[model samples]
Target: MAKRPKVNPNEMSFLDHLEELRWHLIRATLAVVVAGIFAFIAKEFIFDIVLLGPKQPDFITYQILCDVAKSVGLDESFCYTEIPFSIQNRTMSGQFSIHMWTAITAGFIIAFPYILYEFWRFIAPALHENERKASRGFIIIASLLFFIGVLFGYYVISPLSINFLGSYQVSEEVVNEIDLSSYMGLIRASALASGIVFELPIIIFLLTKIGLVTPQILKQYRKFALVGILIVSAIITPPDIASQIVVAIPVLILYEISIFISRMVLKKERKEKIEVKSITKN
Candidate 1:
């Protein structure tokens, strides 16, 4: 392969920018693929422990839920010795397909920080020097929020959902023999959805910086946002009130943090503009 010439981002044409973006994407994809290979190799851990954990009664989440329920004098549905449902591979190649896709999802989650870094590098050139410096911790903060969200989903949301859905049956005659793909899909959706939702603060920061959002607007629409969050929580979690509340709390907290972040961003921008004006007058 020929050596790609070094070109300044400021002087780059549309095609040059496209080429740059392509390389960034390629590197990000390679990172995911590499991480996926490791996850694939660790199939025993991934499948038996991580993926199948919620089905087991002795899982940490279930134990905690049992304790909490007992203390709070609430329903002890979570204290069951076993989940009644069984996971099965109905179709030929079902297990292999689930394994492959699960590995890829694992890879994406593990490689998320590097993916963020690649994304930041692509956009960094367009930002002013001070802007880049101010947001230097972007990748770290975003990654931290994402990982925290994943843990919350895995530990809280996934367990609650799996317990309720896996145990619920229309009749005693109908056994809950969930397909392998379907079970994996629920786990993936819960974790990824929560992780993405936790990026609310970062999204708000960017929107505020670009003058598209204000703290006032977020405050004014707080009621609507709460409704939306509850709706989202309901969709992802079981039909029970406790489950929905558990899911909504963190998201609502994140929304409030987003509002604070937006306020700070605007304050910083105002201070910068005043300094610029003073400098111009001087």
Candidate 2:
């Protein structure tokens, strides 16, 4: 591979920047492909155990909900012996397609940190030394948040949606036999969406850096954010208040944390500016 052209921070050409970005993207893609291959080899564990686990009644999320219902003296409808729906593949090549896609998704999720590292490497050279140091935990924190969101989606959101949708019926004549592709699609969507959503803090950090967002703005728009969060909760969770609230709580918490992160970024920026001014005066 040709060496990426170096771009001076103050006088870098647009073409030079593009060349640097291309190499970073190439590395990131290679990492994902390698991770995907590993996932492909672990098809049995990924599909039978991890993907289908949410459909089982003994899943931990269902168990916890059952306990909650019992404690509240409510109906134990959640404590199901089995989901009413059966997953089937109608297309001749559906199974193979799903396997390939699922492995790719798994690879992306597993290799997320390395991907972020490549992205950071591409951008770090442009940042001041202090800025780079300040963001040293970027990869680790981002990866942790992503994995936590994945777990949340798999254990909470996926099961709730699957159970509700699978068992739901408007008419007794209807039988709920879900397509295999549809089932896997739901799992993939929920997991990936949650993973991205969990990057709120990092998003806020960048927005703060760019002066596009501030703690005040977040606070001022708190009500709107709450409404948006509820809407997102409704989309991700089952059409039940309990499930919506369960999903919304963590998101709201993340929003609050984002506000704090923005405040910290602003504080640091202000302190740095003051020091710079003081040095100039001296």
Local accuracy by lDDT, each model: 0.94, 0.91
Residues 62-104, candidate 1, lDDT per residue (tens digit)?
8987898899898876587988888999899999998899999
TM-score, structure 2 vs. true: 0.95
Model 2 agreement with the true structure over 88-134: per-residue lDDT tens digits: 99999999999999999999999999999998888888899999999
TM-scores for all predictions = 0.98, 0.95
lDDT for position 210 in model 1: 91
Question: What TM-score should be assigned to candidate 1?
Answer: 0.98
Measured with C-alpha atoms, the lDDT of residue 146 in candidate 2 is 92
| Best candidate according to lDDT | 1
Report residue 96 deviation for candidate 1 (angstroms): 0.8
Weakest 10 consecutive residues, lDDT, candidate 2? 1-10
Candidate with top TM-score is 1
